[model samples]
Target: MDLSTVTATLASKSYDKVADICDNLMLQVATDGIGYHDDWPYAIHLLSHFYVNDINSARFLWKSIPSSIKENKPEVTAVWRIGQKLWLRDYAGVHEAIRGFDWSQELQGFVAAFSELYTKEMFQLLLSAYSTISIADAALFLGMNEDDATSYVQQQGWTVDSASRMLTVKKQPVVTEQKLDPSKLQRLTEYVFHLEH
Candidate 1:
């Protein structure tokens, strides 16, 4: 397991690549089938799981980590706290855990990247799920101050009705691809053959 490569990947903020490297290296070199060895870059590996919004994978990784290692490394546990909060969809708690932890210099960038990605996904979800939402609720869901959330929604083209204090979401049109049905295609071909004959 090359710790330096994982460190470099973290600095690059390519979490998917980091995850692939970590998982592949763990499988090849990890002793005793534990998938983790001494000096493993577990924090980033764990964060990489969440970065892809794979909560189940993150939970599995947490379960695989040995109790002794987690006990010794407070950073691992602290980072896992963010995952737990995310599993429960506790946005406030997620932000709190991220801000509350004293992340190492190496991890600060990765954590910041995760925060930005998560916020973006949450904002999209809000836009799709709501026609109108209160600024206070948006702030809570986005982990932003009310004023910032107001400005952010406005920038996204959501109309702000000052008297109502509700941000009307500018929902993007859903464009579903039209998948051709095989049976219909077969019938059309048969009809065409008959007509030609």
Candidate 2:
């Protein structure tokens, strides 16, 4: 069967069904005798299994990857590392591990493909998010009354206050208008006239 068929069957199958298929495919592709002509399809199939959380199937595919082709196949390695880091709860490490690597050059352009899905705001949110910036704390930092913290949190986005080590990163942008406030403008003019005297 083709790679798509294998993927569909594996995805539709129960965990046990997938495990069995993976076991057979592993044997067929892991052998040194078959060239890429025979092995690439199975490799793609094995990697797809991981999409459904079949870590073992993914592990088999990873182990079967030839060292000789690792450089040329940076994407396979990059995808595997991305999965590994995510599975290991190394969120920060995931960014660092893939930072220097161009996703366009890696496996199926995984990062390049997914980067557009994340908005600029979402990316900034990830960058600003940390253990210290809890929603409640951010509201208070925004000059919100104690009782209004919850409301502010729901309505406004806040960042972690790095200096105070509190969730006080939320700042309201000061609104300015081309026409100055009439009262303030008059007061400023009077002050300037007094200074001239």
Give the number of the best model, judged by lDDT.
1
lDDT by residue for model 2 over 5-26, one digit each (tens)? 4555534533334445655655
Score candidate 2 by TM-score against the native: 0.39
lDDT of 1 by residue, 1-197 (tens): 34677877776778768777777777767554654445787788898888877778778888988888899999899889999999888987888889899999988988898888888988998987999999999998888899999998899999999998899999888899999999999999999999999
User: Which regions of candidate 2 fall more than 4 Å away from where they truly are?
Assistant: 1-53, 105-109, 112-165, 168-197
In order, the Cα lDDT scores of the candidates are 0.85, 0.49
Separate clash counts for every candidate: 0, 2
TM-score of 1: 0.82
For all predicted structures, in order, the TM-scores are 0.82, 0.39
lDDT of 1 at 96: 84
